[model samples]
Target: MTKTLQKTTALSTKNGKKSPTDKNLSARAAAAQIILQVLDHGKSLSALLPEIQPRMKPQDLPLLQEICFGVCRVLPRLEWIIRLLVDKPLKGKTRIVHCLLLVGLYQILYTRIPPHAAINEAVNAARQLKSDNFRGLLNGVLRRFLRERESVLATVDKHWQTNHPEWLVNKLKKTYPNWRDIIDANNQKPPMWLRVNRNHSSAENYRQRLAENGITAFPAENPHALRLESPVSVSQLPHFAEGWATVQDVHAQWSAILLEPQNGELILDACAAPGGKTTHILEQAPQAKVVALDVEENRLKRITENLARLNQQAVVICGDATRPETWLPQAAQQITGNKSAVKFDRILLDAPCSATGVIRRHPDIKWLRREQDIAPLVEIQHQILTALWQTLKPNGILLYATCSVLPDENGRQIARFLAEHSDAQLEPLPFPAPQAIGHQFLPAENGGDGFYYAKLRKIA
Candidate 1:
């Protein structure tokens, strides 16, 4: 009902004491709250994970994430099964209960947990929410699901089983001829890719190190990228804290590769938060003068932290990309140590768009993003592109990139930019740049995430 009640219901146990089921109940409670926040309260799962995970025991955190991620991955099938079972939809204050049910069903259908224990824990989880009255109700529904599990699951053909939202499915169908392939790729577990810092060690050497540690990995076409056979935590990575390598998607690692940063050129990474590309650019060309700019201060803080960890330096600025003049002067002064005018020799505008490409990594995007959101995102992208283009020197290059497969945000957006700006010319990329006005890489294509890259050179 209310935020206070929801928090209390999620955390408090009977008699205000911890029981042997403490870990189980807490994990379920955290997962249920996260699902409710994302599905009902319109929050980002990525944003919520950091907030909720710390409150959970370290041993239970993985289970919590598994439950949350599993529910999101098969949400469409779960919703259909839920509708068939429940007499009516969960409403108002009872919405969190619905999320809890989804978590329970997720465990039963997907995880290796025993069905009885899953159902029992789910029933007990309701007690933690002070919905003890619904304990029997939860148990009955879950047991009923077990009885009809075979028939219910049989009706879930691929058409009805897709985890993507309708708007996204329709959009993808219109954009790509092989839409089903794209959907299939998005429903899978994303491979973990490592970007080996050339400054510290070669990718081959790192691959050998991984072998020594009994970890299996393969080199990517890009010499810097290494795709692990299985995903592991950063702590498990060798020289991770020492900055030898960083976890990045193979497709994402291409941004810096395509940008072609030279050793002495001034580079701009607009909308650079979390600094993945910002740090990559420096890693590629350690002597390059680079500026990392983002609008949010907190996100910008992450950029600096990433820089520090990688032992890289950049003039990090928190300012809107649409209003570059406000921060560009300060950024230039920091790079050159002179309060004088400066223009970028190369730029990487990793424009903000509906992140449709990495849906597998973040299934919640399919639920959170709406079709109408695209037009406004295009507007923001256009504004950022126009503003940032002004800062590029004549004959300098700018690489436009997005983790989105949407045509309107990728190819069409670049087409429109080319039509409007006579000074901008499309430059062929080193990799197989797709002939559709830019390079478009589908999800898992060449073992990379679905990404779009358009290299443009400012005509002198």
Candidate 2:
């Protein structure tokens, strides 16, 4: 274990408290703790998983992820099951036990693990969590569930089938004609998509290399994208450490393609943390002078790291997109030698949103995101678009993108922007839908996550 995890475990145990990081914590117990954090404390699984995964036995890592993600994917159904099994709701300090029940129930219902093993682990996990008093209760509930599984599921099947929260389901129904399909897509586990780095190899060549390595990846509509038959660790991919490719969704690759970065042109990628698109742009136009900007200093490091891995370079800046003047002029001056002047040939605003589009990849978003959160997010996206428009040169294109399916954050947002800015002209995408101002790609079975892209050109 790393010193950080060790220290955390030490501190958590110092007060004679049974913590999630307790030395004897089983994988099931750890999974329950993570669920507790997400459901009760409103923490994100993405952030929590990393902190705990390192402490897990390597063999247990996949199980830990599966349980946590699976529990979140069908949370409502799991809660419903709990209601039928238990006399009273598990609350307060006992909420961990409720989470333990969730993990156990999810394993039995969703996974290939034998029911006995799943029940035993959860029962043992209860003891590890200092809920030994509830071990009998856990055992009884799980056993009863197995016996009445058919009847219980039959009752749940009669209810609304969309396992999503009521507010989100209602909103989706109001917006999309095919809302049921969208909800079905969200419940699935996402397929793994790879973006072949053109700097190092062609997508075809990379697919060949994967075949040689016993990995199957099929080409997608995007020339640079490949969808894997199944996800493998990055280490398993041929030349992955050498940056032959990056793991990016096929839909996401369209950002760089649509931006059409030209050689020697200046470009800006706002909110470009984790730098997937930033690196993809460099792969397309190696000589382009790019300034990758995001508000978070820590996230900016990801951009730098991705650049280094791909043997690429870009000027990365830590500044809010809502206040570009604070950093854009400095970045422009560094490249053009004019401190007062700032103009990007093209700007890519991968603005933050509700992230409803990537729910399959991040099931925790279902519970973590609230209905009231959309208006505030719309306001922020509006501010960023309004602020960043001034930095684009006349006739330059700014691609507004989001991993959101909501009209308020996607098409409607763009419609409002176009109404406000006469200088902004909405350009056409390859695939157009009537409901959206730009292209809206809904989450698909084996295709891309739900993504919205609108290209706006500044009138000269």
Candidate 3:
């Protein structure tokens, strides 16, 4: 459930200009709502975006989103600055006032938006916030910010470098030891890339289609995707309606290629929702028997929509991956003609992870994920791996994957699992990258989102 911030301002009662109704809210109001919801209530940004977006105007959406994301991404720094300027921090609903200040500070510190303009609109936003009485407070804070920007930054960096949570930053320093570049890269802008379905189009053909349709193109540094000249929604791209491309980061698309599911084989894509890997599997081998399952049906509906757009098919079911009894192989075999029931040729365990890898697309990750969550996430990955390994046939391949660069969840987890499962043998990846330390894809500044994939064969 999404958490809502307590209303701090008198503005709601005073202004008909802003109301937090189901529809008809300005983008700034929506962004403010998302930011406060996440900060005060600990709701995730991904959860908030889908809820807040439907209520916003397209024109205001981008800036509003930037504010929500940017503040969260650099929140530590924003907060440090606030602490420097204000002796007593605002608390609770009144804390919304400080948070709105953060929305303003994030603009001044990081964004290309000019200082005066950011301050101007932010001060104006104060009016809508019902803190017109505090307009003087806003003006004083912003002017002090403009004059003392450099000195204030000196304080924030020593306190909040890398835009990470304090405990998380400490954990990174502990895990990575001498190097912190991975965390830094994870926080930066993520590269955009498209995977071409070999059945539908080749990279070269898609490049030509992109050029022909007036969409610019360049070959991605990654082998799996053709990078667009600039990132845009897939629907706006050329031949997207024809299913020629998908807006997946380079690391995500590689999971299917590495798994190498064959035609007519029964493959289980466990934890598959918003089904990228499931669809890509079908793209490669259209006749393959694919069963997709996620714990939540609502999440699976996104998978259904993406499948429809790609013109792909998979037997999508909603069930817990942690429980094999919940997903009956006998029933699935009847649906896909793999009635052997007890045996399956392949499984893709795209385990639920802490998601340290995809930070660029979801900056709020910096704020939401606690260091304590890592231990439990590691346990979850281990459990899912064990359950999927149980389903794999002898000599069948299993691709254990995560969109996490964390060593605990990727390499160490796999290493521990290998110790317990004697029959499982590691299958060397076809391509080796440096950060794939025993298959943990480290965050790369020059490359794709962080991902880890290890191929193992159950040799029992």
Clashes of each: 0, 0, 1
Evaluate candidate 2 by giving its C-alpha RMSD to the native, one decimal: 3.9
Cα RMSD, each candidate: 4.6, 3.9, 4.4
lDDT of 3 by residue, 1-460 (tens): 0111122332132445635535455555455666777776767766666655555676777787778877777777778788888877777666657876887787787789888887777777666666677667777897898899888877766553777766766766776763478777866766678888776777888888888878776776455488777767777777777777877777788888888989999888888877878889998889988888787767888888888988888888887878876675644666746754555699988888877777777777766777788888788778888887888889999998888767788888888988998998888876656344356556677577778888889986
Q: Highest TM-score, which number?
A: 2
Estimated TM-score per prediction?
0.93, 0.94, 0.89
**Candidate 3 runs further than 4 Å off:** 1-23, 112-114, 154-160, 329-342, 433-437
Task: Give candidate 2 regions above 4 Å deviation.
Answer: 1-19, 22-24, 333-338, 433-436
Highest-lDDT candidate: 2
State which candidate, 1 or 2, has the greater lDDT. Answer: 2
What's the lDDT for candidate 1? 0.84
Cα lDDT of model 2 by residue, 1-460, tens digit: 0000111122134466745574746789989988888887777777677777666787888888999999999999999989988999999999988998999999998989999999999999987788999999899999999999999988977867787888999999899899999999999999999999887889999999999999999999899999999999999998887889899999989999999899998999988988999999999899999999888776788899999988899999888889977887789778878887768899999998999989999888888888998898899999999999999899999999999989999889999999999999998888846444899889999999988899999999
Using TM-score, rank the candidates from best to worst: 2, 1, 3
Candidate 2, position 18, lDDT? 49
TM-score of 2: 0.94
How does each model score on lDDT?
0.84, 0.87, 0.74
> What are the per-residue Cα lDDT tens digits for candidate 1 across 262-284?
99999999888889899999988
In model 1, what lDDT does residue 358 have? 85
Candidate 3 achieves a global lDDT of: 0.74
Better by TM-score, candidate 3 or 1: 1
